[model samples]
Target chain A: MKAVLGTMGDEVKVFGFWASPFSRRVELALRFKGVPYEYIEEDILGNKSPLLLHYNPVHKKIPVFLHNGKPIAESLVILEYIDDTWKSNPILPHDPYDRAMARFWANFIDDKCFPAFMKAVMGPENEREKAVEEAGDCLKTLESALNGKRFFGGDAIGMVDIAANFIGFWVRIIQEIAGVELLSADKLPALFKWTDEFVSCSVVKESLPPQDKISAAFKARIDQAQTNTRP
Target chain B: MKAVLGTMGDEVKVFGFWASPFSRRVELALRFKGVPYEYIEEDILGNKSPLLLHYNPVHKKIPVFLHNGKPIAESLVILEYIDDTWKSNPILPHDPYDRAMARFWANFIDDKCFPAFMKAVMGPENEREKAVEEAGDCLKTLESALNGKRFFGGDAIGMVDIAANFIGFWVRIIQEIAGVELLSADKLPALFKWTDEFVSCSVVKESLPPQDKISAAFKARIDQAQTNTRP
Candidate 1:
């Protein structure tokens, strides 16, 4: 309920789309940091928020974290800001190598894995199998990366774990929306278990929007897209 | 030249491909840090380096910065490691927000710009235009992000600058090889200037491989791919 102001003491605000996974990542980071933030939901596909545009002139995309007056675009960047500014429970590890490891995996998820998932979601129907295969390869790599750690950072949740949380929650919903299972329990058991533990965390559990609502919103969007023939 | 060993202070070695942009990024970072590292050039596409495989069991790619014994993978991650361990001239800004900003742009370049460039490089003749357009969009965003800053970290070159240095040098060569003009002086004047300045920096200038060698290697790679597809 707290207003999220910019770091320079400009009024902090988050311009986010309700069902966006990227937006959710920022929200979770804020909640974990226990930082006060004002959330302004934008109808990204329909109406653009002036605040979003003003804050993120380049990408003009949500979720844009406006601290004081300076706007930090990019979910991963915003998350790091929250960790740095708040410094309550550090989201990134203290040791540089450990921190680098966390960042490496986080980057892996953002750069490699997310694209595979997106392809599975948006590729042509005939290419679904190929997309699924790509998604599987990405997931397999992720599974190996976990290394029997409770979270990607081991035991406690860290930046990499938070970044990869999309795999746990959104990936399932996306598979459902796209009608393909990418992370079956049989195939990615560690990742599946990690997802359960990740969402079960009090901070994450509290921050998550209702699943039914998200599912409904996604389905509606997909239907609209199918009807419109535009991406 | 000092040996660039892993974190544990084992025999320091780097398994790299002579012409790989990613490998060169690490090599430059190491040289900047004055880390003595043995450079073992690998035939990456045909024959894998045993050290590369042994060091980076997960990715099996370079530039793997092997400190005494521990192997660190990912060029960006290795750059950070080199910066952290050596602490010569810091590659990243001290301010976390600035660091995050640098990281965001770097990630943007790696995830968006590089992929677009690759598409332009490998696409069929008919798809070249679309690929170029995609690459242009990415370059424009990068230009806007620069906003008259000398380097991504304002005055000094940092991790983000190193990550994006490829745009200045390799991109032009790739453009030459692919016969596509994505980064013209008119379209991305700031970036063009930045690239010139970046490559001219004493450390970067000295570390860079010869342009003729790079161009030949890249052309050969493309030719090999084309030949492999011919029936």
Candidate 2:
């Protein structure tokens, strides 16, 4: 496998939590681009690493990519940076409209869908019903957006596909943890098929943390939430 | 006023809601780029215009930019399209890292900042405090993100700047309508200065909706919310 080099130097570092979908998105992007980077795992809920804080002082969030000494925060931003700095495999299309479409869906995932998904994952039983309804709306929109394309960008995994991958992979895991199914295959055949194809991609398959590990981590998180809420 | 023209013989049309910050962002981008497009206002809350539904079938949301009859949904996507399809004024940087940085802040505005701002605007009286606190945190991070740059894109009023312009303008109006001040100059000096500079820009100043109109609209919205809750 060819390693992608950073613009500043040979050393690249990523600060991320183990089970975060955002962190996974960046990891997949790096692996797809063949970028060689050292991963530093952080305890997101308990304590953040000093390096993580220093690197991303503004947001202080995980998935901070450090190329040489300069730090870039936000998974979507880092994906674009990785694609731009290393040109081995382009993650976005060359055409501006195509790029915009990719970004639009990516933003949609971050802005609208993720929130609804989170609500379903972490909410009271009564609120969970509403959350599921919202998630269903989001999934329907995503299903329609896929519209016969093998991938969101068609024939290739691009930025939007990377951004929306969480809905495919993590949503099921989250459902397993939450004990409810959010995405039904019958309702979203294309998205489900795309999910299968997406994980089968050599880069994605290799980079993904084990599903059992993810499920365990998610279960622990829910347990913690429940414990905290107990009177 | 010079009308901003798209490609030769292409009819440019914008499907937008009157008071949406997302729609306003697109309008600002078009006006700044000097692109001429026919504006079709959609009654999004009651009856979504047929053009809006036709143009954006996937999400079916407003601020859909139709250039030569091809529809592009999402404000940031439309902004990118306007910047790319027209070359009169560039909204993003030529350098990829800089462009990524601009996008980072733009995504910051869309994902983090705007949601908090909206929550503060529409949330209940008790929830407003927490929402305001979150909005303040976002603004503080944004202040640090600026880091002495004249605009979010260094010297240029780029895409990120356009994306964040609502925080400078509508936020203040909403704060007034809600009887709360979320952004104080003392708390976020740099952000406040940037807000002033942003609103004072020639195109921005010219294109902004009248303050009285916005205030009245907000008042009506508040009344509607109250009426919906009445027994």
Candidate 3:
């Protein structure tokens, strides 16, 4: 059961939804690390796929990473596992301090940025402004952390960049649907530029979903939300 | 620059708050790894120490780990860094799958169990029952994951065990203050027994806060919560 350079015997599979940023995290990790994985798009908004359900019984969320018949749930946790299993192109930094910092910021995005963004996009009309402000604060911290670097991981796209893929593409798409601009040149100049640079990277550009498709899906979701809330 | 065994050159320090389970995570990690560190308690409720703020400007939380004057924030991230830096007593399993599983559950405790437990304890009166039910569901997942194993890491205490430290001591104290039972023998027998075994482990026992003091602190917090909610 030894892992030879390119061959790890285990069949790699990813059960994911097209528009989910969590799914995109795993996709980018696999692609960046040069690991071969079959991607299965799950029907998340409708009937839950049995494979996803079986693989992820507890959370039952998309982006369930299955390596050699073993399923690993949670996007960040799965990303780390991918980095560990595939050592050819290391996703995390070698230095322990730098690695810890990368993980800290990634966890911040997962626990802070993503949630605040969702609240801003999906929250009630009366609360959207406050949520947008909170989300802006989260993004501001991220912008400051970049510290004039091109990527969160300086000079290259690394773990923190992969963790922040949502900011690069999904945030704008969400903003388009919600008709609220959270990431602007004036408020977040560095982050605004970071997003453009991040999404344009060859690896990221190849993996990104079709912009029109995602935009349409988000528009439908917003319409559904409005319909559910009508007086 | 090089970290020699038992003598990692740089001064190790842990900025923590008493009665904070997150703080205990770092203390237990340093103790278990046999790493020498100076513990500096922070006043989390009152004015936070300047050192804590300086080290961790983002969250401004306690248990900011300092190794050779460099700060690493977030307890889970710190735990991983400690394990990575210290090669002698490895905190995480070497097997990639096992390590991923450990990280997954540790994250579950942080992202799911603790939050649900807080909601159940601190949620408004009418929502208490639903919150309690949700918290119970979270505990049920933890119990099933344990599946008669002595510890989450099989025999020895590891990262998952450290993450679940709150369940061993703090949850009961919070339950005592809230007057609600979430981890009773009837409800979570495996977890109930697991907590007993977890707290008795020498490293965990030594690092745990004094029961009476933590209980008093919880009482004070509960009283403050009640006062804030009064019309």
TM-score of every prediction relative to native: 0.86, 0.88, 0.95
What docking grade applies to model 2?
Answer: medium
Candidate 3: tens digits of C-alpha lDDT, residues B126-225: 6668988888899899999998899998888889988899998898778988898889889889999999999988888888888999889888877776
Query: How does residue B225 of candidate 2 score in lDDT?
Result: 64
Which candidate number has the best TM-score? Answer: 3
Task: Give DockQ for candidates 1 onward, in order.
Answer: 0.55, 0.64, 0.92
For candidate 1, write residues A177-230 as lDDT tens digits.
868788888989998888999889988888777888978877786666445544
DockQ of 3: 0.92
- On residues A1-231, what C-alpha lDDT tens digit does candidate 3 reach at each position? 233643455588999988888899999988887778899989998888988899999998888998878899999899899888787677899988899999999999988898888878876767778988999899999999999999998988998999998899988887978888889889899999999999989999999999999999888887777566545
TM-score of 3: 0.95
| Candidate 2, A1-231: lDDT as tens digits | 123335334677888887788988888888887777889999888899888888877678999988777789999888888877788678888877788888888988887799888777776655767988888888888888888989997898888888987876888777878877767678788878888888888888887789999888888877776566545
Q: Which pairs, if any, clash in model 2? A: A4-A34, B4-B34, B4-B35, B4-B36, B5-B36
Whole-model Cα lDDT of every candidate shown, in order? 0.78, 0.81, 0.87
Error of 3 at A138 (Å): 1.5
